[model samples]
Target chain A: MRLRGIAVVWGVLAVAAAAGLFRLKYEVIALEERLATLTHAIEADRRAIHVLRAEWSYFNDPDSLDKRVGAKLDLVPMDPAHIIALDALPFRPKPVGETAGGPARPPRVLNPGSAAPIPVPGQKPATLAEYTVMRTQP
Target chain B: MMPALLRSLVRRSSRRGAFLYPGAEIRDLPGAQGRHPARVRVSVEGQAKAAVEVGRNRLAITAGVFALAFCVIAGRLVDLMALNGGEAEAMAAAMAASDGPVVGAVVARSDIVDRNGVILATNLPTVNLYADTRAILDPEEAARRLVQLFPDMEYGETRDKLASGGHFVYLRRHLTPEQQEAVNLLGQPGLEFEPTERRVYPQGPLAAHVLGATSTDNHGIAGIESSFDRYLLEKAEPLQLSLDVRVQHAVRDVLLKAVDRFHAIAGAALVADVRTGEILALVSLPDYQPEAFSGAPADSRRNRATLGVYEMGSTFKLVNTALGLEVGGYHVTDGFDASHPLRMAGFTIHDDHAQARWLSIEEILVHSSNIGSAKMALAIGGDAQKAFLDRLGLLSPISLELPEVGKPLYPDPWRPINTVTISYGHGVAVTPVHMVNAVMPLVNGGWYRPATLLRQDPEAPPPGHQVVSARTSDTMRSLMRRVVTDGTGRKADVAGYLVGGKTGTAEKNEHGRYRHKALLPSFVAAFPMDDPRYVVLAMLDEPKGIPETHGFAAAGWNAAPTAGAMIARIAPILGVRPRGPETPVAPEVRFATASGDAGRAVH
Candidate 1:
């Protein structure tokens, strides 16, 4: 009687284990399908982005802009006289209610959180030999 | 008795109660004998017991058969899952290997961009349409519809391809998405779409010669595209060039107008940084659309600035002057006699500007005296002059980043007469790029920076050797300033830009002699002469004299004024700070006062 009871218990456990294994096998197949779908979608999005970036570049071409909108917008080349030294520009006045000379706000930076030093407006730009901005995004 | 019991078992099963006895238990079953043979032994005789033994043997054989089947199945599972991971790894490797070229093909080629990241050339993903020709039910009808959809497709060609009965045929390539949709809406079987990439030029002929074009297979065929094809194919990043489209537009705009006004056959213009040797703008008019470069006319496809070698008239005077200063050991103030024609080596050398008296080296250039320049070149000697021009990179092809660069034409033997003609810019012929490159070091404090189209790192400039003393460069700068201020390049002088340059008007050499009607006029200019930063060059092929030019198709009339307009247009975009009159061209103050009198000889 004890042996029969033991056999019955083992049979039930084996049936449960078989059911779990089949469930795991199906889950693997479903996960693989999902992975393939996501990969294809990501690839498709990347292709779309490439097309959009190219179109953006096309729209911003200088010669086309000059032809299409130069006269309509009354655009003209900037004159050397229009570019002034930093000292020539007047300092911005304090806000209307802000106190002067007491705990002034820190300066606003262009590239926030970056460690590069803020450029002084009137400083001479670096020479072409000294300037390098190749492949900054890559 | 055993047979009788078997009979009773059969009768018990078939008829519900055929073997019924008073209080009889369930009738003995033959199939149950294997499990409960003890009852059969007690009820039946010795013969029945032997039959039961045979039943037991059959049961054992059936159980063994089932066990062997399960063992075989388990062994196959293990073989598939464990012992031979090698096949699985190979399949995985094959998948990974197939992935690499697909990604590479999608990149196609790196973009060609201007210095400011404006796209000059790029690639767009597209779909190509193909067909299983055998699947088409009606070739003529389908071809007609296809021709209607894609107007560029020929009806006869499409029909022929459709009826070819081939397994696969390409209908069209590089189709737009809308066209793909229109084709899909036809709902035809066996039609397929193949994704691909095609090179595109966004700016369209703006810098066509610089960006070049690609072939149908997406291989570069010309210009920067050909020169850096390998690098472009390998790298995914954009290829950055030194060209600035804004400056190029200014140059193109001015040069186009000048070419139109002068009625020239063609034209070319270039601007380069004197210090860095970076070309900012290069325009060769009669330029073609890069998108259709292969089909463009050969005349428009010629890269005039770097390919067309011509006898650059009086502009060689700048090199002659520098050569004189460097190797001839002539003082700027020393006088050469220009009062009469120079007869040397079976040639009569004379002057166009004609100052018929003793003239200084400076005066010779200011007056465009061919006789005086020839005399100076004779003193410099043929060998020394050749050597000097060679050091300036004028005797050979310029080491610029273009496949179209032409080798400068000069007398290889270095004859004395060759020296004389070369001095006044006659015998030697060079492309416009070499002219600009040769003139750069003379005014840029004498550094031989070879021209490059690639954008360079400003912090560590490419190393260059000094070709002349700083003093010679200083003298050349002042002399160039004087040219704009006083001489033939007068039309090139801008009020605040302090433009300095030389003008060349060579009678176009036909066969072995110069022609009177055909002309090649060019001007090379440097700005803010005190600290020269940029050099601008303009050249025109066979320009006719308009009424406004007073029928003078000289460099002074057309090329010089064109250079001036170019400077005015591009200076603002280049960020050159303009200033008012600050200093004189030269400190040595002297002018030839012999206009009225052929004065005393100083030579």
Candidate 2:
């Protein structure tokens, strides 16, 4: 009687294990199908993005921009006379009625950022190259 | 007896085992010593009964074992076929993760970008629509539907194609996805979409000649496209050219307006960096849209700047004076007589507006005296002139990154007449690119760098060949500056940039004779003559006399002013700052300190 009881218990365990394995197998099959579908979706999205990038570049073409901007904007090409080298600028002039070294020491000129202004004749900076480095201080 | 018969039958039967059942029950023969006891009586009925019981037990055992084995096998199959399904899913997910985003497909040709990384030519993914004609059950319906979707398609032609019994046929290529979708909606079983690549020029006709065009199969057929076909097809990286779109547009816009204003047959303009040998802007017109390449006229398709050789007229004067000073042992202070036209080998070489007196070499160039240039070339000797021209790469086709290079036309024997005529840019014909390439060395310290369409790193510029002495180059720059300041190229002068160049107005040679009315006027210029950074050339082919040009079609009136406008527009963009008049020119270009009044002496 005891042996029969042990056999019954072993049979029940075996059946339960088989059922678990069967459930796992179906779940795996379902997951694989989902994976295949997801892979396809990602590939499709990637191709779409590629197409969009090409179109974006096409629409932003310079000629098209000129046409689209039209008469609303009165933009024009730059003029060379408007540009001046930094070294070509005229120096700052002295202030009116002020002595050469009155109090501020002429506002520390090697540094235009701190220099007092009374624009000098033929000394005014013509372009950013001169003005950018005129300020000598930290 | 029955037991024996049964055993024998069982042994003889191929389907049954030879061994008899060990558990046989001796039912009728139990302790049988009765009656005939014949060979242990072979009790048939009892033995038969016992054999039947034994057979039943054996069959039960065999069935049980088979059932157990089948159960194990079924369990293993379930584990592998169904239970391990998750493994496949995991593997697939890992594969997808590993692959990440899709790899970029090999483009039929690499994109061509400008110096600043603006797209000029690119590949766009498109679909080619085709059909399996045999698969089309209702050819007429399918063709009608296709025609409706694509208005460009002819109904009868499409119908005939679809009705054909062939296995396959291409209907249309380079269709947009939206068009593909619309075709798909037609529900034709035979219709199919084949993914393909189509080359696109986003800038339209802006850089047409430089970028060139590809064939229907996407192979490069012209311009830089044809030259760099291998690199374009094999490389993944975009090919960066030296062209600057802003400058290119400026050149084209200015040239187009000038061409239209003059009612000229055609026009060409170029901007090249003096130090780098990089061509920033090259415009040839009337240009055609690169996208609609098949319909362009042959004339419009010509890359005149690089491919059309013409008597570059007086622009060659720059080369003449530079060579005279460099190798002919000529002096800036030397005097050349231009009082009368000189006859050289039965050809009269004279100035158009003769400066009727002895003029300095400086004044000779400013006056554009053919006699003075011829005298100078004669002084240099024919051999020296030929060598100089050869060194300038003007005697042969220039090697450049374009398939459409022009072969220079010059007198083969190079007689004294050829020498004298070539002195004033008559006997020799060269492309505008050749003119600029040669003149660049004169203004940029005697270094001759070959012209290129690809961008070069400024920090690591390619080595240049020495073309002239530095002293001669400086003297040449001063002379050229004098041309703009006081001579024929005065109109090309930009106030702040200190522009300097030479002007040329050649009568167009037509049907083996020069047409006085038709002219090829051109100007070659370099800016900030103190330290030349850029060389610009503008040419007008057969421009008619216009009233606004003071009824003059000379280089000074047309080509010089056009160059001036182009320089004014592109100078600031090219980062060349304007210097005030008070600012001294770099010391090198001022080879001579003498100041002069030659305003009327030049003409």
Candidate 3:
């Protein structure tokens, strides 16, 4: 009886191993087919890209560009007299309010040394001023 | 172990002494330990039992070995065929064997690109449609269908091709994909498509002569294409030329305008980076579209920049003056008498608008005095002048990558008349490329770098040979600057840029005699003369005098202004800064007389 029992166990193990092997073999075959299809798709994409690049260059030809530029852009060739070195550029103008006799200037800090208290995460809000209301009627 | 068993069996049989009777049968006798000893003993007829036991033992051992080997082989076979993914390898092998059209065909010819990586020439994948006439069941039907699909193809020609009982015939080549599909829908028997490459010039006729043309099989036939055919085939990388399409267009536009405005036969222009010998732009007209190589006029196909040779008028005066000063050790202040026309060997050399006085070396170039240049050449012996020109690479064909270069024409005997006329730009003919390459040394610190079509790495320059002393080059630059400031090249002077050059207006020599009306006017110029960077050369063939030019057909009126326009457009592109200060001239290089229009914009 023991020998028969052992034989039954051995037969089950053998069947399971054979079944696993077949699953692996079919899986590999399917993967290889998928890989080949993907490779073919990639090659097709490359050919499309090549054709596009050639067409791009054809359209970007200088004569065509000159025509397109003339029609589309309001640009002209830079005259030599208009071109100047960096040294020739005028100094940057003062800020809007900082200009001489134009307007009052603001300090580097808008409100000098008046650091507001940090807001607590879960604190109840104090009553806001009329002008400092956070939200207004939509 | 089997051998031992066989030995025991023999020993027992022999001990029994069964051999006493030759044919007696031996049976098992009960031993002293009577535990069924008969069951363990064997009975045999005679010595045959021992022989049989030995044979059986050898057979058993052999069978065991073979059985083990077979088991091992079976295990390995199961490992490879069943356990591992061996099918993947098999599939890979099959895939490699199959010709997958999706992978596409390899490009047979590499691309030609400009310096900025712009594609000038490329290949387009196309199909050639052909027919197997022998397999055509209905030639009339196939031809009818073909004509319907491809309207460009004639019905009669298609029918003839299909009716001919040939194995194969080319119906149409370089078919577009849409056309191919239309033909395929016909389902005509014996019709086939062969995938091939067709060369394309994206820039069209912009650089036609430079990019060249290709054969039906996509092999290069001319220009840079033919020159590097093998190299382009072996390598996949694009060959980058030194040409800048922007600069080339600018030059071509300027030249075309001049050609059209002057009613000239044709024109040519070239721009070179004097420092690196890199050709930035070269234009030749009438230029043909590289794509439309057939049915082009022969004159349009000629690359005037490098192939067409002409006696380059007073452009040679720069050569005469430079050589006269450098080789003859003459000073820039030296004067040549131009009071009378030079008469030698039945030929007279005179100025166009004669100065009619003694002119300094600078004035000769300023006025373009043919007599003055002749006197200077006479002063420098014939041998010295020839040696100088030969050193300048004017005596032989210039070494360039193009195959269509022209050989320079010079007097074979090197007679006195040849020497005198050649001095004032005659008796010799050279391609414009040679003229530009020869004059490079004048502005390039007296070093002559061979003009190149390939882009040069500025850091790794080729060791060039010295063509003249640096001091002489300095003097030449000043003299050239003076020419633009006050002499024949006055119109070429751009504001805020130092322009220096000489103008030559040579009458075309037709059938061994000079034709006065048919003139070849050219201007050779160098810009920012203080430190020259580029040399611009412009030439107009048989330009007629227009009202704007004051009815004057000369280098000063047409070619000089063309060069000026080209310079004005290309300077900003080349990163040449225009200095604000007025260009100053040296005291000695100034005109001696308070010159009138004689040395001005007149040839």
Candidate 4:
């Protein structure tokens, strides 16, 4: 009885090994196929990126850029005189009420430190409210 | 001669001392070991049993060895076939082998790029369609199908090629990827798709002359392409040039406006970094498209900046005055006689923009006085002037990456008259490239770095020989600056930039005689004259005098201002910060004869 039982166990182990081997083989094949597909996809993406970059350069060419939005954008090449460094700007102005000669304790100038930057030529003019800076602080 | 049991019985009997009886009846014995002759002994006794045990042990040992060997072979087979995923390498090799050619087919010869990593010339992957007529059983049917895919292809021609019974015939080349897929979907026999690469210029005609063109077979035929063919064929990294496309665009933009406004036949310009000798922007007008340059006018295909040698008019005065200071050891305060035109060796050395008085060396350049320049050149003589120009890289073809470089034209015999004329910019002819090369040392503290198209590392600048002293360079800078403020190049000054330069308005010598109407006017400008950083050279060919220019086609009216406009636009791009005072106070110049026309620009 013991001998017969051992024979039965050996048969079960052989069957399990065969089943595992079959699964492993298919898994390898599946992984290989996936790898190849991904490689091809990567290659295709690279080619597409190359083409798009070329197109980007063409569109950004100075002639085309000028033709496309040069007028409508209210833009122009920055003149050297206009390209002042930030350091060249006057240090952050003192709270606006202090410079505008308002009363020492004057009604906090309604909106202090809210003054907008002066508009450059060809830019939209600053609104009256944008002219307020230390009015709020005072 | 007995049965098996009988022989065993006989041996046992012999062991029992019964061998004396031959031919005994073995059947009567207890078979060999038990009851039958074939029945083997289950167990033996004494010495007979010992001998039988030894023989049995030998059989078991032999069987064990064979069984172990088979077990080992089975394990190895399982290991290779399935266990540990150790599949046969040959199987994976086969898979990759099927894909190897497909992957290898898409590479190009090489790419060409600008210094900023902008792709100038690149390859686009395409497909070529061919047919094997022998394998194609129904040529008419295939051609009919092909016509639907390619409407441009004539059915008759395609049918003829397919029916020629030849092994291979091209149906189309450079098909788009979408079209390639459409042809593949046809799934017809005898058709093949071959991967091909087509060279394309993304910037179009922007840097066409510098990049050049290639043949259909992908061989370089001109420009940098022809020069680097061997290296390009072996490497995949891009060939990087020193050109800055943004600067290039800026230059082209400014030159186009100048050429159009002045109604000039052609134009050329270049900008170089004085410290490194790197040419940032090189422009030649009437440039051809790199793709189909063969159909363009031959003159448009020429690289005027590097190849067209012009007499260069008064631009040569920059070199002459430098010779006066550095070689002749003349001081900036020294005076030269310009009171009368010097008639030397039959050539009337008269100045069109005449200052009929003894003028200082600095004032001579400011006035653009030909008589003054010729007299100065006379002091230096012929041989010394030639040696000076030779040091400036003007005597021979410029050493550069482009194959289009031209050899400078000068009088070979070194005559005295040639010296006088060459000094005032009439006798010697040089390309705009040579002129730019000559101007660099005058402003960059005397480092005559040859302008190179290959991008250079800023940390390791190329070595150059000094052709002038630092003091002479400094003196030249201030003198040229005065030209912009008080002399013929007044229109060439940009506010706060401290621009300075010399104007050359030379007549073209056509058929061995000078044509006064055919003018080649040019301007060479250096900015922030205190310490010059960039040198810009602009030239216009045969510009007509317009009413806006007051009917004058001189360098001051056209080329000088053109360079001024270029400096204004490009200074900010070249990282030159606008600072300091807008206009500088002019110091008192000795012997400068109170000048007129501070309001009028002259050359």
Candidate 5:
């Protein structure tokens, strides 16, 4: 009886040991598969980042900017003659305020050495106050 | 068998012994020998047989274990040699081939382009020549032939490289395809060719400051190239910027002509798409050609559009006026007394072109009165002014993708004096990019979008924020138009385009004092003011008054007329049709007045 009991205990231990060993082997295999999947994902992400950075570098190129604008805008190259200087602006005489007669009287040109004056048509004579007021008004 | 033999021998000896020996006892000798001889032999034989069986069994088990272990080891060896041997051999070969010292590797670079799929920058294929000096049979002959092929190569340098006992040495880098072919014809055993990449700029110096140039080894050193180095080095796709090449050429051409006409130290121009916040064209001169970047002077390489910050003169009046209308509740027809200079905090604010009378808000902007702007700023108060400018991105360093950006320079601790000076664009300094970006909201329906360089998906969500009221924006547009049509920016008016803009001429700060003789002339304008689309800006640095300018380097004399020429030349190219002769002028300004205020209805 005692020997039989000892044999049963030893049998249980051997079965348990075999089961544990098989489970350990399967666990190692599962872990390796997970590691491989994760590694692939990481590599893919790195490649994507690389592609985006390359795209950025390409877009900022200077020659490309010039061509697109030229094609889109119907522009011709300009030279110094195209630009006008402030001094070249034609001058205009100041205007005057309205009078009861329906309009202000035009400025008159004084004759040399004489009090008599020659009237200019379609031109209004403006006072200092009126000119200041008009100049300030938008 | 040996035991049986011994037993028989003993028996014979016992039998032969004298049984009758007088000294031998009968019970001790003769009786035992006769009874147990056969039994003793059988027991001895059985024991010997059992020992032999055990020895054989033990030997059999040992042989079985040894055979199993040997087979497993042999199978593993075959698996390794057959399954992975090719890769292992290749690795070994690579190791052997790289036995010489190594210099820097020629790494691949990235491509650059405009937003419209145009190639602005690219890396062309090139070759580098190298030599295995230890393999050279005649160093003198090799050096002489190389020198003859490449006259630029110093003879002494080539000879030293050839004679250096090292196994490998670099002969030349960035060799053209023709040069490589010529070298290959020599057929020197030690000579080898290594492929490399060289950066190429197709646009010459049109956008030199913005694109920047790379070094010989393909490392970016300035502008957007240097700023986005890591992206350029690692990314595979080309970078797409929001610049338009045609606009860049137009703006540059106009500014170049202005520079020659006015003898300006430098010039810059920028055109921005207000709706998308894309910088259509940005030009800075004197600009350097990227192809000859190394030979350019330091000043030529500086990006004035995005790097140099300056006081923008009367241009700041637009911001102040907007703030007054928005925060101070001032209407377009609100009146301000411009008859006298305003004195505050020991400073007198006066307009260079004074208007000595009570002027309406619209008139003040049209005339660009310094005193009027000061009063409006005072009405808005200091806190509101600061907040408005800050919200407009005028109080800090602008956050753009490019590395060559400048920070706004303002007085610390925002004082009243600073506020007054800033109102007239005196105490504050900002880059031209900042000015263009800040003004975008005024014409873009009050939305502020940070500029982008990449091509954006049309389906993607919008990437901007609203910074002003749409009503205020419309009002500002009208005011800008009036300035061009009948006020200070008359020179910027393009016929049939309804052009609108502001003019500025700032005195250069020299030795802590304003230089009266030197002026920085600038103009900012937008076309078809009814529904603003694009904002254009041009500036001339320290432009000298010329004969044509009547000895005046003001914005009207220099920058404004340049903008006009640029718009006229570029308008049709931008797909904007010239207005028909009968097209009515768009009424830009809508005057809001106090109810019952008696005035000739100002439109």
Candidate 6:
């Protein structure tokens, strides 16, 4: 009876050991596959970066830019006399709103942060709506 | 019956006892039979009990050892999980990070441009091919195919390289796009294309000396490209230089023609905007193509405009006369006796084309009288001369954006003797750039704007320092105009333009002695003097006198004419309208001496 009991215990231990080892093997395989996938993705990214760097150099070539500019714009080559100082520019103001019948009004000096002028009695004031309407008409 | 059966059993036991003892007969061992049977039964029972006890002890020992080992392992696991869990996790993460794929290396490179938004130098992307030998399936076949595609590549070399067990090997660098495509179609495992920056110069050798070139690794090796290397590699915003390609080509073409005509040793030219101190064109002869820099001789790579310093003979007269009038309290009407050569320190200073008459300050400059210039320097004194030259950026290396600048060779003691020789541009040495920069204030209304490689911001006002009085500057402009129209620089005069300039012809110093055969001829000029805008200079090193030059290698013959041609071509490109000859020169000085006779003789 005792011998039989010992044999039974040995059998149970051997089966348990085999099961544990099988599970460990599968876990290792899964991790290895995951590592490989990550490596592949990273390598792809590296190749892309390399291609981009080369393209950058090609586009920046002076001849390339010159050709592109010539093709795209109506640019005439400029000389030193074509360049002038900013101070030398003639000062001119933009024209005011257009209307045939309306009387010419003095140009308004708009202070960036100042409050708008208050309307006085017996004076026709320009309201916000009127201003918007005037601006849309133009 | 029971006794008979017992007796039979006893007889059987007695027989077994007899065999065990080997001496007793069955009939004689009757009592021994019963006792032996009981003893045998007890022995058998005891043996069974011993075996059971041994098995139970062995099971208990195994269980004890197994439980102890399990406890130990569990304790270790707990310790690792609790006490060192964070560290273990960190270590694992570090390992994973290390194992992670490497990203491509990115390099920042510099940018180059012409003054007018023309791209001269730029960094572009290119593909470099590499291979993993270990990943190659058939090295021999791959090598054969590769050699077929690239005839330059040796089959044996490619095979040996592929056979090298290294994980990575560089097959080629800077492969063309078509080459890259061909390599890609091979579909060889472990082959890779790495991105790298390649510097490209679009204008080739047009402005090679000024623009410089970069090495294969995208390092600046020469010229502005090399000098501003750090700024370029930092991927800083594009540097817009003051160089105008149109003017640069004009200057280069004329100088190259002259170089070919004369077979001169070297030549250089510069065009600067006087108003803003902007350099429009700079050309050095014996130029190299930036792309194929290897083919150029070492001497051709040297930038003569900024790096080569020579005694700029009569050109120094411009600075001398300007300083003399400024420091000696002299006016255009101030007259100096030039009837005889001035002797000082055993050296006699005389005019090249001697007037042998008293000359006013303007006449002295017009005639380029060495004696008059030396006397004027003596009046100014040594300390004042030093201070004035230091102010003019002649006492030291010119401060320019480019790194290839030569130091001015001037006397250290600043003695009267040094002053006298320096006044006529004999003892002093300076680059053409220095001479041009020093002369700028004479025309730009007394303000001196330092030369720059950066583009000017139209909205922001340009920065400048006052180098001379506006009145003095106006006076110098008028004097320079006279030099062009009625004096030594008459050959430099441009039609429909009020041009003003000075000519210099100095012998080169060889073996500590001036070589009379070797001359440095230079011309510094500004056009439309009534409204000074640009200062242009042209120089020829060791120029030979040709028949066309009337067998003369003087600045007036070689450098002045070259400058005149450049101005004519570049002025139109720069959009400078040609002024009619009738346009009066500005800020005309009144002569205190009524020397109408002196003027005609001087001319």
- C-alpha TM-score for every candidate: 0.74, 0.74, 0.79, 0.76, 0.67, 0.65
Q: Candidate 6's residue-wise lDDT over B344-463, tens digit each? A: 888788789799998899998998988888888888887888888888888788887777889999888887998898888988888888988898998888877777656677566378
Backbone clashes for every candidate come to 6, 17, 1, 16, 30, 8
True contacts kept of 3: 0.31
Per TM-score, the best of the predicted structures is 3
4 or 5, greater by lDDT: 4
The candidate with the higher lDDT, 1 or 2, is: 2
DockQ, per model, reads 0.13, 0.20, 0.16, 0.20, 0.03, 0.09
DockQ of 3: 0.16
Q: How high is the lDDT of residue B380 in model 5?
A: 77
DockQ of 5: 0.03
* TM-score, model 6 to reference: 0.65
| Worst 10-residue lDDT window, candidate 3 chain B | B594-603
Per-residue lDDT tens digits for candidate 2, residues B1-603, read: 567556555655646553444533222233465544334344446878889889999999999999999988987677576646367567658768755434444456778889988788888878899999878999999988898899999999999998888767899999977898898888889998788899888788999998888898988888888899999998867899999988898899899999998888999999999999999999999998887777899998999999999998899989999878988888999978889889867767778869889988898899998899889898889999999999988888887899999999888898998888889998788999999999999999999999999999989998999989899989989999999999999889887888999999988877679899999999999988988999999999988878887789999999999999999988988988675533433432232222432221111
Worst 10 residues of 6 chain A by lDDT: A81-90
Error of 1 at B292 (Å): 1.3
Over the full model, what C-alpha lDDT does candidate 5 score relative to the true structure?
0.76
- Position B341, candidate 4: lDDT: 88
**Ranked candidates, highest TM-score first:** 3, 4, 1, 2, 5, 6
Give per-residue CA lDDT, model 2, range A79-112, as digits (tens). 7655644434345555778785554553445644
lDDT of 2 at B156: 95
Which residue pairs clash within candidate 3? B314-B504
For every candidate, the chain B TM-score is 0.80, 0.80, 0.84, 0.80, 0.79, 0.76
Query: What local lDDT score does residue B367 receive in model 6, on the 0 to 100 scale?
Result: 87
Residues B181-270, model 1: lDDT tens digits: 999988777678898888998888899988777898888899999999998898978899999988998899889999999999999999
Candidate 3 wrong stretches, greater than 4 Å? A1-35, A71-73, A90-138, B1-28, B36-106, B133-137, B165-167, B187-190, B581-603
